[model samples]
Target: MVIVLDFGGQYNQLIARRVRECNVYCEVLPYTTSLDRIREIAPKGIIFTGGPASVYAPDAPSIDPGIFSLGIPVLGICYGCQLMTYLLGGTVSKAPVREYGRTEITVSDSSNLFKEVTTNTICWMSHTDYIEKPAAGFTVVASSDSCPIAAIENTERNLYGVQFHPEVVHTPEGTKMLHNFLYRVCNCNGDWVMSSFAEEAVANLKAKIGDKKVLCALSGGVDSSVAAVMISKAVGKQLTCIFVDHGLLRKNEGDEVEEIFTKQFDVNFVRVNAQQRFYDKLAGVCEPEQKRKIIGEEFIRVFEEEAKKIGTVDFLVQGTIYPDVIESGLGKSAVIKSHHNVGGLPDYVDFKEIIEPLRNLFKDEVRKVGLELGIPEKLVFRQPFPGPGLAIRIIGDVTPEKIAILQDADYIYREEIAKAGLDRSIGQYFAVLTNLRSVGVMGDERTYDYTIALRAVTTTDFMTAEFAELPWELLGRISNRIVNEVKHVNRICYDITGKPPATIEWE
Candidate 1:
């Protein structure tokens, strides 16, 4: 196990993901964690993450000096490196020429930290302070043009530090460096696999909800489906899944959900076709927040009614994953259209207890769990669909026709992505049905129609995302298909904006 002490780096979770990629379990903790608590986990290695603060500041965060004496293999990154140097009687001074982007680093002694690193390597540097002097036991391993102590290590103490961020993909050898740390330094067995996770999760669920009826709100997405399947395996007939189709689904999605849940998984599912109820509740609702609130309240009411009809349901099972819990209530607004059901949940709900089987997993890890649980690949790796369904996809009004148009456009976008064989590579790909309509020439005649924007992104976490680089030929093919096949869509465009200024979804 690898333990990362988070000093408030934005990429702290990225480090954890890299460690997990090497089949090693890792967790991130605040820098304020005590040495005694650290020892309790008995981690094989420790990583210190970068932060915004300079180590020379008067009120900067400082860890206990005793942490180094624990004899665990330690790797410090960026600001973490400066903190280690300053704590060990070294000097760190603010430099006038701060580096914030790419820098050239030359290997000094070919230390263990840079075992396979080339003589000249490109590194991602983001630091304003420099390590002016090294501690007594540490030696300079690598150096950049601007910073003298680019990397340092004390093999005897099993400590290593790098001034650049190796966890980021911008650094070419980032993944390789992380692999070296996990395999060479920590000597991990590399045995954490999906099958083991599934087994453990099943055991935990059975133990937690022994003889208790669990009611899961199935949203027909991969996460909810996988959670429902796992719960069924835990307590055979004691689980009941309620799938609410709130009049906001894509074309024929409610029937698909009913057919799949009842026919494939064979779980005891209650199909609540509350389309008219949802439409009636959402009459004259133009604001996004109001729509979300109305849908949320309706969902809870539907679930409560289903739970009562099914007799005593003790546990309210949810498919709330890690990112959903992190984004909400942290004062962080949704950067993308968050996987719904988890995002826009109502406050008013009465249930015995809540059970979230996939709470600790990420989006990718949830797919792995689904694969382990024998879910079909098509359903497991399907592009994420929002819980609000086509309601969010329709830019302005929530009408059946608007949803139909958006669904047709979205279907074309997804079909093209899969046809290009980029579905697995791309993190998320969706179509945004813009509210504005423009005039166009069709068949040498002037006509007015709606425009559809295609968006695809590649990201490990949806928090920060960049537009995916789709091949030009594939883009052209998709645009042609959307305009020719989908009615009322005369123009097609691609979304080139990242997470900050533009979200993945228009709504």
Candidate 2:
């Protein structure tokens, strides 16, 4: 197994994803993990993830210097590289020009670290400091125009460092670089796969929750669904899944999820209809982040009340994935969106422990695990829905009338997409109920109704998404059906905004 020391970089989990993509088992641990724990895991190699801090910062994270002397191969990335250099008697200083995007690098040495690396290659660099010179026993492997010491290596000790990120998609050869390090330097057998993950996860779950009652918060999303199935398999009837339908879900989603959990799966499933409770709490709330926080806190309260009715549960299982954990700034990443599941557990919960089975896996990886756990393909590959449900999709105050209109429109859009055999092609496609209205003449009559926005994005990893170029005919069909069938929405417009400029959801 390989271990990644996370230093709070955004791509820290991506490094684990790439390593798993190579069929090499790996997990990311905190940077402050002691050397004793590193020796206990006995990983084939160690990867230090990039961080958003300079090595010289007063409170910057640092690893024990004894890690390098353990005879295990070590690869340090952006901030990791600088930390390694600073600890090994090398110099790293602030660069005159900060590098943020793609840059060209020329390979000076071609053997160990740069096996298939071309002489001139493009790399993704995001750093404010650069190594002025290599550490005492290291040799410079590659250099770029903006940064002099782009890559450094010490063959004798099997230590390597790179100033650029090889995990992000910005670098074309990023995966290849990581592959070389995995196979050539670390000597990993490439033995890890989803099947192996399932076997280990089941075993770990059994060990963790031995005959203890565990209640899972199933949201029917890939993450929660996979977690529910996994825990059920581990401790049969000891696991109970309580799905909270808080009125903000998509059209008929509550009933659909209930049918599956109750009829399809053998796990003990409880469907709680708390729609009125959410409606009362979110009556006047309009701010997006505030809506998320309130929904998160309310979900916990509902779950605790249900647990009390069902006796006592020792653990609370959540489908908190790696992206949610990282983006919640659990490992020092900047707060992107305050995912409702990550940090909103109230202090008054009955469960003493929170078990997140898929915490280390990404979205795509979660789907893979879901399939491995024998879950239905349709449910496993379902489009990712936020924990806040349609609450975040609505621009302003949420109402039952607005929800019914949006639900019909969204259902029409999804049904048409499936009919066109484009359900799997588009990564995520949904309809948003914009709280704006436009006046239009329909059959010689002036109609002023709410406008609906259609958003479709085509992406592999959801980190960076591009707007899907849906055919004009399909868009016209969706628009016509919503306007003709749905009463409140008379106008529809396709959102052509990319993820960088505009998030997937408008609210």
Candidate 3:
């Protein structure tokens, strides 16, 4: 496994993700991590993540120089690279012209790290400083116009550094460089599999919760259900899943979650119909973030209430995956969004011990593990939804009137997408209801009601995404179904914009 040392770089998690893509597990640690702790892990390889810091900064982060002499293979990225040079007796100062985005670099001297990588390569560069001179015994292997010392290496010490990021797609062959480091430099065997991870996670969970009961905050989504299943396998009836049916869920979703968990899986499951309770707290909320905050708080209140009824429980399991944690701003990263499981933990909650089985895994990894554990494909592949549920989908204030209209329209859109066999193709597709109302003629009656918008996108990572190029006929079918079946919705529109200018959700 590889260890990624974070130095406040935004793309730090991406580095860990790329290593995992090479079938090697990697954990992100803060740059301030004590050297003794790192030695305990004794990782197969160490990766230094890029950051928004200058080596010349008076108070910039630094690690012990002895780390280079520890004999562990090291790969340093942009900020990480500069930090390496400054700490290892090399000169690093601000560049006259900062290199950012895509830039071309030429391989000056050959090294095992660049094996099979092109002599001339387009790399994603994002740094303000450049290395004036590399450390002692380190040779310049790659160079570019703006950043002459683009790549530096010391093969004898098993250390390498690159000025550009290879984790992003802009650097097409970046993953290859990491593979070379993992296999050649580090002599690592790629043996990390989700099945093995599941087995180990279950064992750990059981040992942690022996004889004590565990309750999961089940949201009926893949992440939560997978966590619930794994815990059930480990502690059987010792785990009780509480599915909170807040008023904001999609059409018939409450009933579906109950049936699937209670009748089919049959592990101690409890369904709470707290729709009115949630709605009461969420009344008059109009702002998007405010609504999310209120819903998240209400959810915890429900969970705390459930735990009190269930008696003694050691842990409260949440369905928090990697995206949720990264989005909520963890480990030298900015907060893109606050997930209920991440930031919504109010001061008052029943269980202090939180167990997140899928915290390290991505969305795709969770789905794979779910299928590997024999979970039905339908449940595993269900469209990703937020813990706040439909509250976020409603553009304005959420009410029974808005919820009913959006639910029917959303149902129609999903049904059409599935019928077209585009359910699995589109990354995340959903319907949004606005306070907007448009004029339309229905059987010679002039109707001015709600306007519904459809959104669909394809994404490798939720970080960057592109709008799905859905056919016009498919859109027409969805539009027609919504207009005909769902009253109070007269106009339908499709979101053609992608993640750059617009996020997937309207709010």
Candidate 4:
């Protein structure tokens, strides 16, 4: 396996994704990890991720230089490139002008890393300090106008460094560079795939939950469904899936979820229709977090009741992924805004253990895993819906009427998104119902009703997202349909803010 030494770069995960795209297995570890610990993994190659900090910083992270002596192939990225230079007695000075965007790199030698890549290629550069001199016994194989030692290679030691990012999609030959590293230098076979991962995960899960009954909370999304299926395959009757329909699902979603679990999979599925219970709990809830908390608490109560009927559930299975846990900062005890399943768990609630089978997988990878599990493509490629569902879509105090109106608006939004042939292209697309209403004259009669805000975001992970750029004609059609057909919504608008400044959901 190739090991990625993470130096706190945002693209660290992208590096891992690129490695996986080459069909080679890779795992990420903190830069502070010791060389001895690295040796235990017996990695075929190592890739150093870029960081935000300068190598010369007083509090910057550093790795033991001894790891390079292990004779394993090493590839250094931007900040990693600077670290390689500093650790190997090379010079890295603060750049006279910082390089931040696209730059052209000229390759002097195309034998190893740049084998299949063009001699002159566009690359993504983000760094303040630049490598000024090559390390001892290292040759400068590539150079750019901004930096002389743009790329370096120690042929004898199989150590390579690139000052620009090759993992990002913007770098055209990034995949080729990774393929060469995994295959040519590291001699690693491209054998890793979703099926193999699923097989290994099943074995590990069975061993971990031996003789223990596990209850999986199915949210009807691809993540939970895939998790439930995997757990069922591992534990069979010992695994029970409890689905709580919070009356926030889209049209026919509850029935669809129940049908898939019971008829198709032959899994023990407990369908609890607690719509009224959830609605009752969220009677006067206006705030998004408050509504999420109420829904989560009600869901737990329903699951708890069902679990009590069964008695003594040893493990609680959640489809929690790394992004969710990382963004929530579960370990740091960051003030978690009730995430229904994850953040909503009460402090007083007790469970013997929690199992997250898909914890290490990303959203797209989750879909791939679902496909490998023989799940229908519809579920695998379904557009992402929020955990709180249309509850968050209803801006004001949630009522059955509000839910109905929002559901209709949301359905229309999805239908139009698909009609525009942008369903698969976009990641998550939904509509939010705002409390404020605008006056409009329909058939010469003045009417005032709720305003529905349309939000569509394209993202690899929900942690960071950018609003989708829908065509003007398509947007107009959606707005017209919602206003003309769906009652209670007098106006429609799109959310343009990104994730940092504003979340995908208006609430």
Note the clash tally of each candidate: 0, 0, 0, 0
lDDT for position 319 in model 4: 90
The total of clashing pairs for model 2 equals: 0
The lDDT values for all models are 0.82, 0.86, 0.85, 0.83
Q: Model 4 compared with the native: what TM-score? A: 0.92
Candidate 1's residue-wise lDDT over 137-237, tens digit each? 99998887788889999989988899999998789988888888888888888987778989999999999999977878888888888889888878867
lDDT sort, best first = 2, 3, 4, 1
Could you report the Cα RMSD, in angstroms, for every candidate shown? 3.1, 2.8, 2.4, 2.7
Model 1 misplaced regions, further than 4 Å: 108-110, 325-350, 440-447, 469-473
In model 3, the Cα lDDT at residue 135 comes to 93
Q: In model 3, what lDDT does residue 110 have?
A: 68
Q: Which pairs clash in model 3?
A: none
lDDT of 4 by residue, 345-431 (tens): 544344588889988777778888888878888778887777778888787798999988888888899899998889998878888
Of the candidates shown, which would achieve the greatest lDDT relative to the real structure? Answer: 2
lDDT of 2 by residue, 288-385 (tens): 99998888888878877887888767998888887777676644445678665633666666778889898888888888998888888878878778
